[model samples]
Target: MTIKAVRGKRDGPTLFVSAAIHGDEINGVEIVRRLLQHRALRSLRGTLVAIPIVNVHGFLNNSRYLPDGRDLNRSFPGSPKSSLAGRVAHSFFNNVVAQCEYGIDLHTGARHRGNLPQIRADLQDERTREMAEAFGAPVLLHAKTRDGSLREVASDQNIPILLYEAGEALRFDEVAIRVGVSGIINVMRQIGMLPPSRVKKPRRQPMVTDQSYWVRARVSGVLRALVPLGAFVKKGAILAVVSDPIGDTSGDTEICAQDEGIVIGRTYLPLVYEGDALFHIAKYKADIDEVLRHYHEFREEFEPDAYDPANHDPSEYDEDPPIAS
Candidate 1:
């Protein structure tokens, strides 16, 4: 693990930003790189703790689990006398996470999947909601922190953390990376780490959802997605079609939405078996038109004409360079 601290001359929140906790999720690594390149941090009032790659063992192997076949994320607040993953998690919690006042964990979808830019936070926390809104992602999920997860561990210590999910694992999506970098900077501004922007805030507020579910394939076949990610669909809407690749509709199955929700995640690979999750939807209580309007506005903000830093490759810092005393 590598750590970078950009401390301000004045005292402020120590925000810990971590990425690549799942190893294959490389978009967060790029997000951290781009975040370090921003000039706004020069005027920062707080400390920014950046750890671009937390699971070095998994990252080097391009695998999501550690050598011991354990997910590093599930081993939070681990013990020194336990497994390898446990030891790693224990060291991280003691030496790094223990020192921070706030945190932002970046992540992407698993293999063969893509997620729309969204913030998964505990809405029960008012400060967390404010930070999530400030991040300005199109979708906000009232996600409950899983047991033994980083968010839960942080919450125990009274540190509010936000998790940003976007793109796909093992690949960098330009749109995902751009939105992530901007979102992190926005949160920094909102929390007083950096000066506020003179430009007005985002025109459309992020759509919040408390209920989400995965629409699974009913039969084994080649899958065809009818709607893309971020699409607003009503209950019973057809989200995808599964058909036999050899031009047979006898085995076809239409995966329909079970609730009026937005498509927050979907399988990118067309081939799928029965019970495979195809479209992940999030239900909202407000008018569907409002969600549609917000989605459209978010897309327009990232039009081709707009500047995107992900279009260029930024140099990554060498991990743990020797510091001159």
Candidate 2:
């Protein structure tokens, strides 16, 4: 309803697509901007409200937390009597989000980390689960809602909000960005707010995993990961090894997998100390090999080679492709 919150087209179910709630998590900002400019939305049957940069201060500084050192994502549905971040969240929730029938929140891994494109939702909630499936992201996680988080607050209100995680903090990856923009459009199409999509074929629905753990470093040293995000690993596999930068004595410096699953997030900063989170893996018993294949194929469809962006340039892939919408 306000100027900062830009809405495109009126007269249909209002869908809110928000990004940069964590300030430094900006991949979503670009995704939302591109989403607003999509030509396909011309025939949209509903209002699309896009807030590209939610926390302008932290976004400018590439800081994940607000100036008050509070994580904005954890301050949702806040109060006017609270701090700056809280007030903004409260206002947006009470005014903009409250008016929407469905919502999508885009995000990325924290600083010094990278995440495979995936959706995190409370799959236990019927509506939330539906939207997560409709989102059509390469993978989906049925994570429980954290207290004070936007997803939790919205769920409490019975509003289904899908949280999309990908890329890395303070920077952007072209593939992750592409996946996010396309995913949002697919969601719009799924809800019948927009016409059917024409892009890469939709990926299979991701498995629902309730438990996840961040594999952290037990010894401080230079680290080398054995697999990247989206890679499948069997239980008891060697995930990573840490040693001195100059290859000093290797005295028990390794992290092993606790269960069979796929790597959803990993650290980029090789240098680390004891107790630093290195990998975020979700435990699942599904055909993870198929899940991994879908993850890579989803990205490959948009590129001729992951090493060469010139291969599947947007200009080249710009023909009619199967889109979720």
Candidate 3:
């Protein structure tokens, strides 16, 4: 529960950027680290509150849920007089999120899953849509507000926010971190909290989709993916095949895409049970060619080795207090 506030000399909108609410999602934590190092923050016009680790208990335990086995995210806008998770959420809302005019909640795929870099926002709001487009991810999902989630509460308070999802939990992906850092900076600039970047906007808009679904494993076995993440697939295209490790094709089951879409997420671990989520596809109802063009440009921009964090030091994070026995 560490919050670092970088306040600008001039008065402007306060923007809060939070990460690691699920604890195991370390990519967001790293993104905040790199974001703090940017020279742009020195000239920032507004406040940037960085909360790299929110779930201290779950983070220390390498788990997504709290010690009480409650999902911290599901206990949002919580109570000061309730469970530990609820109290923590309540404290966070009051102390950190209360003052912010805007926010960006960073995240990654759950354990054993990897996600393509994307922005999930309520596009119905013009302000939110502007921020999402400014962030410049290849995919922009018009996600609905889930009950008890931070996004829901923030929207309720009329504070527009974006959820940047990428990479996988418990690991650092350089590309995801780069995209996250740059995207946050972009949003700041878009809202006049910071100076506009010299970088140009994408030639094409992000693949905006209100529809996405998980392609589940059809059988219990070792899953082998025939396609890579970010690959576009047509309806009924084979995405993966689940087969026994002992060369038993007799029980093989091929998982096919249910719609023409892009692979937004996939399972990293080969072992899976029947009905386990294997692929998450985002359908492009229109502008498929333009979307593909943007995808290639995004890859070229944030390709591996384009940015290296090894030279930068981000060790300012504090250790959580030890629990009493």
Candidate 4:
């Protein structure tokens, strides 16, 4: 793994930003690159450790697993004597992740899937919750760490880590990249790694939800998505329709929402099989209209052309220094 460390003149907290734990998730790599180029680092308070590609073996081949066919993410805090994935995980966790007080693991949806920009972290921890809110994603998901995932191991060691999920694997979404960069700067300011904004705007309050589920396809067919990502759906709303690609509607199936929630993720591939996951919906207690308003506002705020560092105030909480073209 390649590591880049930028230390500020003043001592403060150490934050490690990692990407490509799933090698095909390349958006985070670009996010890390832009972050390292931001002029804000010139005045940063502590050290920023960036690992743009943690699963080098998988990245080299455009695959999501190591050469051993093991997922690097699920082998975290691994034993040195274990398999290749485990050993690599062990080295990275010890030499890099273990050395930081806080962390941000970047990710994207699985291949052929796309996720709405969101923050997934254990919100029960006060520090983690604060950082999640400060990250300023449109949605903050209260997710439990998996058995052998990086978040689990880091949390076991008392490190507050946030996982930012957006875009799709092996693809670069400009909006997602910009959001990732801006969110990191927000978290740094919140953690004292950077100064607080001189211009105080109303912080974007992300809709928080602990309940979410995947709507699966009932039959194999061509999928026609009726709802877009970030759409607020009502219980029983038709999310998509699955019918024979040959235009036979006789056995068509309408995938409907099981509960009222927001669509946070969905598959982009039109072809799917029986029981395939098609949409990810997160339930919230807030008003539906209010939630939609929040989503719309977030889109406007981070629209590709909306983020121009040159026109942005350097001390603003949501803005960072210019990144090179």
As for candidate 2, its clashing pairs are 196-325, 197-325, 198-321, 199-321, 199-322, 199-323
If candidate 4 were superposed on the true structure by all CA atoms, what would the RMSD be?
A: 4.0
Candidate 1 structure quality by residue, lDDT tens digits, 1-325:
8899999998788898999989999999988988898878888997999999999988999999899999988999899999999999999988889898888999999999999999999988988988998998999999998877888898898888999999889988877887888899999988989888878755577788889999998888899899999888888999989998999777788889998888999999989998998989998768678778888888777544433445533444322211121
RMSD of 3: 5.4
Which residue runs does candidate 1 get wrong by more than 4 Å?
A: 303-325
List candidate 3 segments past 4 Å from native. Answer: 201-203, 306-325
Ranking by lDDT: 4, 3, 1, 2
Q: Which candidate is the best by TM-score?
A: 4
Give the whole-model CA lDDT for all candidates, comma-separated.
0.87, 0.79, 0.88, 0.91
The digit string of per-residue lDDT tens for model 2 on 163-280 reads 9998889886777777777778777777778777566564575656777778899989888888988777888889998988775765648788888888889998888899999998
Tell me how far the alpha carbon of residue 128 in candidate 2 is from the true structure, in angstroms, after superposition.
1.9
Clashing pairs for predicted structure model 3, backbone only: none
Query: The CA-based lDDT of model 2 is what?
Result: 0.79
Better of 1 and 4 by TM-score: 4
**Model 4, 1-325: lDDT tens per residue?**
8999999999999999999999999999999998998878878998999999999988899999999999998998899999999999999999999999999999999999999999999999999999999998999999999988999999999999999999999888878998999899999999999988777978766889999999999989899999998988889999999988788788789999999988999999999999999999999756767767877888887775545756677577554432332
Off by over 4 Å in 4: 306-325
Native-referenced Cα lDDT, model 3: 0.88
